[model samples]
Target: MRLTFLGTGSAMPTGTRAQSGYLLRHGDETLLVDCGSGVLNALARTDVGYEGVDTVVLTHHHLDHVSDLAVLLKARWLAGETDLTVVGPPGTSDLVEETLAVHEYMQGRLDLTLRDRTTGTFDLAGFTIESMAVRHSMQCFAYRLQPADGGPSVVLSGDTEAFPELIEFADGAAVLVHDCSFPDDVDVSNHPTPTTLGEALAAAEAELGRVYLTHLYPHTEGRHEEMLASLADHYDGQVTFAEDGLTVRVED
Candidate 1:
């Protein structure tokens, strides 16, 4: 399984990183994890097209996470693609319904499937997805995806606060794409700090092979080394500060 970091920035975008977006690919199946602002353009930068993306899974309804959703739907509709499936939290269906309501042109042009689930496991094409609700300001979820053919598993922490449950959810994952939004001393509530992340990983029952820190804000600028140092104090593992367009292949 291959995971691509389409956007690595936080709610606030930086010059280099876009907002929250990730693309997972297994064979011919492509799953877009989050469709935040600039994600369509980012996907265009890759070999994928908006019309080719048949499945989308969102963690929450935050604008930074779902800003370009309607745009993508419209583009696909215009491209004569009618079938699409959207999976997310409770409000996911409402979000899409409201979006399509505003754009009457694409009303009957596209066949949209909305699945609103919380804290469960489901199958999406060749992937088995396990979802758990995380501690966030809103109703948010973290996803653990495993290939049906017994390939590597990846866990994506959408936008969340530091909690041990998150570690458990990410247990045994080849890659834990966590939301490390700030440094330890930054004192943010709804996001994770390096210290908190290390603590959680240390207490986790499963050994995470690698960790990729994403959803960074400007406060994290020039502090990557500092964050690494802090994380090293608790968890001794391979870690990388994710950047846009960074592709990571998961191995079992």
Candidate 2:
């Protein structure tokens, strides 16, 4: 499996980064996690086209994560590509319906499948997509996408305030793509700071193979090295700072 960071920035966009979006691909299947602004443009830069992305998994209803979803769907329909499935938290179906309703012209142009995910296991084209509720301002979830054939699994901790549930959800995963939004000193709610991440790692010390930090805020722009240093104090695994367009291959 290959994971690509389409955008690593937080709610706001910066010169070096876009918003929150990622692409996970294995063979012909491409699954999109979070479709923020400029995501379609970012996809154009990669080898995958928007039409090839059939599944979308959202972490939460934050605008930075789902803002450009409708735009992408409309563009795909205009480009003559159909068959789309979007799986997300509780409000997923409502969000899709509302988004399509606003763009009524593109409603009947494609087949859009919407799945409202809560806390349970779901099957998606031979892959097992498991979701666990996390502690966030709004209803949020962390996703673990595992191939039914027993391949490597990936856990994406959408946006949360480092909680025990996150540690449990990420245990034994090949890669944990978590939200490291702020610096160690900066305190923020509904987002994980480096200090909080360290505490969480220290508590469970799960055998997480690799850790990739994403959803960075502007406050963390010039302090990437410092953040890595802080997280490394607790996590002894491979630690990486997610950058726009950076891709990592997952192997068993």
Candidate 3:
């Protein structure tokens, strides 16, 4: 399985990074997660075109997470690729309907399916997806994707605060992509700092293979080294900071 970071920045766009988005490709299936602002443009920057995305899994309905959803759908509709599936927690269908309603021009032209799920495992495009609720200001989720054909699994932590459940969700996975929004010294709510995330990982008492940090904010601009050092203090594991267009493969 290959994971591509489309946009790794937070709500605000930086000169280097965009908002939160990712593309996961396994075999011939492509699943896009979190179509935030600039996500379509970022996807265009990659080899995958808008028409190649057949499945979309959203973690939450925050603007930074779902901002590009309508645009992607519109583009796909224009390209005549209307067969699509979007899965997320409860309220996903409602949000889509509301978004389309706001943009009446594209309301009746899209043909897609919407699934609203909470905590369970389901099959999609030959992959088993497991979702778990995470601590956030809004209803959010973290996903674990296991290939049905048997290979290394991948876990993605959406916008969340440091929580032990997330560690368990990522246990034994080949790759664990988590949200590290700020540095240790910054006082923020509903987002993980390196120290808190490291402590939570340590408490889980499980082997989470490799950690990739994403969803960075401006406060974390010059504090990458300090954050990594703080994270190392509580948990010693391989960790990499995510960047837009970064691609990683999980080996079985």
Candidate 4:
């Protein structure tokens, strides 16, 4: 699977990093994970523009994550696409419904389908996805995806503090893109600091191929090296701070 980082910043927008969005493409199918405020513009920059994205999978209802849903749906509609499918946690349907409610102009312009996958495994965009609940401000989830045809697996830890269960869910995946929202000195909650994230990674020892820390806040502006150093003290692995528009491939 080829994954692209559309937006990597936190709720607060950095000029370089927009918000929380990621794109995964395999074969002819493209699945977008989380569409934040600036994600639609980012998507336009890719070969698969907003019109080419067949489906969008959201992790939660946070504004930073789903801000562009209406915009994307409208973009697809204007591009002459007839349908768009959205899959996410339990409240996904409600979220979409309310979105259309607010944006009354967007009611029924396109054929919209909503799927709530809160448990078990399901097939979406040619991948078998297993979801688990995560620690967050609201009903958030993390996803583990394996392409039906083959290749390595990828895990996405939506927006959560690093925890053992989330790490275990990511075990053995080729790539684990997690929520590292700030540096160690922030004293924040509902998001992991680099040290805490590193400690969790060490305790679980998932041995993932490469760990990309994303959802960065402005406080993490110039602290990438310091943050990596702190994380390396506990968990030694191939780690990087994901930047907007950076694409990563998951292969065996």
Candidate 1: the clashing residue pairs are none
- TM-scores for candidates 1 onward, in order: 0.97, 0.95, 0.97, 0.97
Q: What RMSD value applies to candidate 4?
A: 1.0
Candidate 1 has an lDDT of 0.89
Residue pairs in clash, model 3: none
Which of the two candidates, 3 or 4, achieves a greater lDDT against the reference?
4
Global lDDT of each candidate: 0.89, 0.85, 0.89, 0.90
| Candidate 2: Cα lDDT at 196 | 83
lDDT of 4 by residue, 1-252 (tens): 899999999899888887889999998988899998899999999999998997999999899999998889888889999699999988898888887898777777879889888767889988888898999999898999888887788899999999987898888899999999989999999999989999999898466889999999999999999999999999989999999989988886
Stretches of candidate 3 above 4 Å error?
none
Residue 20 error for model 1, in Å? 0.8
lDDT for model 4, on a 0 to 1 scale? 0.90
Candidate 3 on 1-252: residue-level lDDT in tens?
888999999997777887889998888888898999988998987777888997899999999999999889988888999777899999998988888888877766878799899888999877889998999999999999988888999999999998887898788899999999999778899999999999998899678788999999988887888899999999999998988899999875
Winner by lDDT between candidate 3 and candidate 2:
3
Quote the lDDT for 150 in model 1.
77
| Candidate 1 lDDT over residue span 155-252, tens digit each | 99999987787888787889999999999889788899999988888887877878999999999999999999999899899988999999888886
